[model samples]
Target: MNLFRLSKGFITEVHRLFALFWWESSDVEKRLHWGSWDKLCESKNDGGLGFCDLSLFNQAMLAKHCWRFIKWPNSLVVRVIKGRYFPTSDFLHATKCSSDSFVWKSFMWGRELIEAGSRWQIGNRSSTLIYEDRWIPRRHSFKVQSPRVLGRDAKVRLLLNTSAKEVEAILSIPTGSNLDDYLLWHFEKDGNYSLKSGYKLG
Candidate 1:
């Protein structure tokens, strides 16, 4: 007894590829309802049926790991985890990380999709990571008495090189820009940004 039957779409595709085998089967066994596919793919709790969506599940699990790396980039444990499971590619490589050497590639491939500004959530629940967005004016304390009055080009240069600590301080002023945009620009230009000790999550 075939307790579980294949979905109609799957059956149709299989039959197309194995027409000879299908044709040889009895006519009574070949019949299948089109509605059965949707029912079989629905969750058991929903009352329609029980079927696993392999592709969606894979994407969800990969997204979880992507969250992990962003939160703990410098952890020795993270490195070990990547090295053992994904040894060859860089941590941000765009390939899937099934083995020890592919972690970096996996991260690279999915990084943009799970960016800090994205509104994606875990398991269709609350937001996965908390973040704030703001724009900040550029300034150099040692060179200029009133850095905010500096020209746009000068401001950009100042903000780009300013340490995170200084940026945090200037951000406190009621200015045209906030810290969020400054951080985003810094990361975009430099490819890396440092988070203050308190800003890092455990």
Candidate 2:
């Protein structure tokens, strides 16, 4: 279904199945509803059953596709999408072409989740623009608004070492021959997205 965004009607129909089980009813008959479905969807702390709202869960699941595309560019699906829609750039900066497919648009809708959890892991720094990309942990971008900011054209590649073995951003600009930087997800050790993590993000 992720080939396109699921329609509201489809989601509601799926929810109908859940509602049948929820109220201890069947498709053929009604049963007593102990509480509103919205209340059942609320967190336990909110005095409800903590079921994830299905609509939001659906979106989060779809957003997982976006997360996967960002972190796993080596995958076949990523390769296809990259070639088709974003050959010139990485997923983070990819803009839609007029020829975007339904799935690409569906994936694009989930881009915000990718932005929320990703930070550039500085490597060659070629793709990252200094002060423009978020790299320095905790601060959004370099946080340097001063007109006195150093070397306006600087890139993340400046943070590499002469040995090209380690980062050297402390006393001088890092310089390296590496050709690309990468996205790192803040929540996972492997930087992989899972349904559980996506739920947390939701």
Candidate 3:
């Protein structure tokens, strides 16, 4: 489930089996379902059995692979995939190709979930785009809401007015150290992606 994308029918069948087990139904006799499957999948705090939604769980598992791509860009798998599918671009910006393999396609599918929950943490600011990337510390949509005055290629560093000390209040702080800008899972305090959070987000 983590490495491959399961079909909807397969997941449905698995859920059906799970339901039978939960209700203690045998092959000879069927038991009445006490509640809807949706309710059963809800959190225990919300009066549910807290059963894992297989489809969402599968997505969460796959999202972990995508998260790994971002967290470990230098890994062998990422390097090979980058060389083949996105030689000139990155995982976030890569588009699906007609000739892509099944495994790569599955990884891309996982990437969609990663996109929903991940955001950029500004450090060096060279990679953090001022408008396109999510860097602003806002509630929803961590992007610049103002009209664009800078070019599309403008980085967060470009917005910093390091030339004047007084302009610091109006702009983002300058690159304090040599740390590189990186992606973060905003749902976690440690800024790391976890299956539990990914499942909930899904």
Candidate 4:
């Protein structure tokens, strides 16, 4: 499940089996379900059994690999995957190919989770795309809220250094550092990914 994305049918069947097991139902007989499957899958605090949503769990599992790719970009495994899958681009911007392997596809699927929770921690080199990347450290979305204030290809450094009209929000962000900018897991205080956080985000 961590290495490959399971088909919906398979996950559905697993959910069915889980439901039957919890309800003490037999394979040959159907039983009355007291609550909807969704209700049963809710977190314990929400008053359900906190049963794992298999699809989301699977996605979370797969996302661990994606997290690894980002956290260890220079590792041998990441190097091999990048060389074959996204030689010119980073994992977040990699495009899909029809001929890509199932493992790569699963990794790509997992990348969505990372994309959702990731933000850039601006350093001296503010090369992040102003409209394309999330770096503003704001609630809701870190990307610029205004529509097309700057050129599509503009970088974040432009806002910090120049007198751009729509830069009040950008000006609030602190900049100028000695190190390179890096990705951060916005949900975690330590700026790292965890399976639990991934599952919630999933």
For model 1 the TM-score comes to: 0.31
lDDT of 4 by residue, 119-199 (tens): 888887557787888886654576766666678888767753433443665666566686778888878889898889889
lDDT of 1 by residue, 71-132 (tens): 57668877876675456754444345345244444444334434432221112212121122
Q: What is residue 69's positional error in candidate 2, in angstroms?
A: 2.7
TM-score of each: 0.31, 0.64, 0.82, 0.88
| Candidate number with the higher TM-score (1 or 2) | 2
Q: What's the candidate order when arranged by decreasing lDDT?
A: 4, 3, 2, 1
What's the TM for model 2? 0.64
What are the runs in model 2 whose C-alpha is more than 4 Å off?
25-35, 45-47, 97-99, 122-131, 136-181
In model 4, the Cα lDDT at residue 185 comes to: 84
| C-alpha lDDT of all candidate models, in order | 0.39, 0.66, 0.81, 0.82
After TM-score superposition, what is the CA distance of residue 62 in candidate 3 from its true location, in Å?
1.5
- Candidate 1 vs candidate 3: the lDDT winner is 3
Residues 14-84, candidate 2: write the lDDT tens digits: 77778798788996789988888778877787798887676667666777888778767899989987898
Q: What value does the lDDT take at residue 128 in candidate 3?
A: 83
Instruction: Give the residue spans of candidate 4 off by over 4 A.
Output: 160-174
Clashes of each: 23, 5, 0, 0
* Top candidate (lDDT): 4
In angstroms, what RMSD does candidate 3 have relative to the true structure? 4.6
